[model samples]
Target: MSHKDTIAAIATPPGNGGVGIVRISGGQLESVARGLLGRDLPQPRIAQYSSFIDAHNNTIDTGLALYFPAPHSFTGENILELQAHGGAVILGLLLERALQLGCRQARAGEFSERAFLNGKLDLVQAEAIADLISSSSARGARAAQRSLSGVFSARVNALVAEITSIRVFVEAAIDFPEEEIDFLADSDIQQRLQQVIDDIETLIVEAHQGRLLRDGIELAIVGRPNAGKSSLLNALAGDELAIVTDIPGTTRDVVRQQILIDGLPVFVADTAGLRESEDVIEAEGVRRALQIQEKADLVLLVLDASTETPENLPVIPDPKRTIIVWNKQDLVAGEMPLAITKGLDSVIISIHNTSGLDVLKQKIRQHAGLNEASEGVFSARARHLDALHRSEKLCRHGLAQLQDFSAPELLAEDLRQAQQVLAEITGQFSSDDLLGEIFSSFCIGK
Candidate 1:
């Protein structure tokens, strides 16, 4: 499945460093090597000390040249690696020289696509590589590492096997005519179908947790203009990101800050105060705050802890996950005192005094399912979840068909499509279109 393009790229980041690498892969490795090496290249998979010369046959820079032969190399093609001194000017010169020697610059994610096509990695593993690169939490990183090692793929494969076996049995029963036992009435068939359903249920739970690890939790901060909304942001961010002022309406627009809490990424957005305003600008700001709150994973409805109650909150609908925060206790009693009977199962805190922030953190951790993410959590993507949902619906439909119509052909057909849907999780049933979409998300040079 490998392509024929001679792709090349700067393997290291774009900057000056101790060393840089220029990676190349194609079907014409020998010709490219001979043209640059000024002599016959060494056999595949062996590194040789060599000097890179220009078109005019003058010395450029000397480095180790390693050649990996086709079918055994990454991308299942001929591969070459040139180690050179790290310098922007130096690396740019090398890249320009290679283009002059019949190599083309690779597009984003081409190398990883090649690896996927060559069977070095399935789609799940390829995606896990991206997850590992962008992991925000230690828990996230560990789960992604497990996914890259095929933990997630193995589970998918197991489910696919179970589905295939069930389909085979249904198909066989359909082929046999005049049997005394009806396939649908058999207790064995019912038991097997139920088992598949149970397995899917378990996977969906784990996959949902994994999705959170990859996408992170979105948090919204809403309150009156001066109820320490900005201060809460500044304190959690460890930087003066939001403008803190006693003046109301100091922040008319949402101020977004990305903060890591115990290694978990929380995108805390400090929104405009939710209150009636005479100014046109303040009215628009409040409207925008309502919009962001709708999509927040957790909403921190901030109120003045000194004397404010839940009734002080704006007329926003209660989100599925809400962590009520009573801020500005520093001005009230110098310490936050929690009273559960105040109507909100919330936490009280002082942004300036830094009291009760720990309680807020604990609440956030619990709301995000991080409190239960220590074990059995694997990295998953939205696409994987969608596929599972599709398979799940089809399984339900097939079960109904089996019990009602006694249609073995219909049951077999559903199971077949179900297997394909499940296989997409591990990329066993991927189309070129799906592959293109998947690989296009990666950075060039992988």
Candidate 2:
């Protein structure tokens, strides 16, 4: 775990490829490279062709050797990369040779961990590396790239700078009581505090969108028997993911499918129809349907327009997060029922005709808080949102203390707390445990 110890790992994936790399990073990289390459360090940042040698001077594999001197490498330490034939056994032998040369195998994310410890990268950027690698969509990859390039960090640092200035001003007012200046009531102080609050609000909104893009949404399609729930799922996914039939309870279990809606992944689960049935299998399906509904981020209540009346519409849980979709629009002879509207977002769509599905998708996208414009979107995690929310709460509480209680001291302390919470986002103030939990999720030799 200590950065002082040299670490080496096969940087390539665990399969045979055209080329494989063994990455070494630490202070002792120079000696390790000499032992493996049997030559003086290659020119810095230059890929020199060389033959890797064993302890007995036996030629292992001839490829390119790259060297990055300390303070300029990915880990802010001396780094050596050996490019050899990508056979699994060859890469393993190369890694083993480095281990014999006094290098230990790197733990998961050790490279990025070293970079973070050495001030080469902030916590957000360090996390962005993994996000970028695992992004499923093009937009997601672009957003993660922005975060890795420090766009997200810049926003967080700007807020931290503002908070620092406020603390200094407030503390200064408290320190000099002889001036008899009511700093808490001063219009300038109020304006500055309000501006900071406003800025934090904006950041929170953007961070929310980033989180949705990173984590996506969980959507469950639930309704009574023969309500075209399976049809809607197929339409959204643009594939035959679920079996459709005229027989009730055709889908006896939950069928899951993932679809990208404008770069945001939506995990759609088509659950069995919700109805009371004496059959054991059907009844279990109904139970599971209710369970999925409780855990889903958004629920689509599909109702057959021809058979379902407004008065018979099932009571939905969490009406705000639920969308009522009246399906089979073509079957209904006259105007559709409008009485079921309970302020919930409702759409009338004929899954057979492929009509109104776009509106349904738009509603789902709105649920995720992602607009058509993807500008300024960055990769974020749940922890970032949590920190932002706590910071905002502290700022609001501090403002309340200053305005209502006229307690400048209390306001200053709240501001400090807010500052600390925001610092956690950028790793300025973080615990070893939090750092371990975060980086451990990353792949080794990151």
Worst 10 residues of 2 by lDDT: 336-345
How does model 2 fare in lDDT?
0.90
In terms of TM-score, which candidate is strongest? 2
List model 2 lDDT by residue over 1-446, tens digit each. 56689999998888888999999998887788789999888999999999999889998899999999989999999999999999889988899999999999999999999999999999999999999988988989888998999999999999999999989988988999788777865778888888888988888888888888888999999998999999988988889889999999899889999899989999999999988899999999999999999999999999998899666677687987898999999998888875767477799999888899889889989877887878888989999999999998999999899889988899899999999999999999999999999999999879
Q: For this target, which candidate reaches the highest lDDT against the unseen true structure?
A: 2
Candidate 1 residue lDDT tens string, 361-400: 8788778877554576778999999998999888888888
TM-score of 1: 0.92
lDDT score of model 1? 0.82
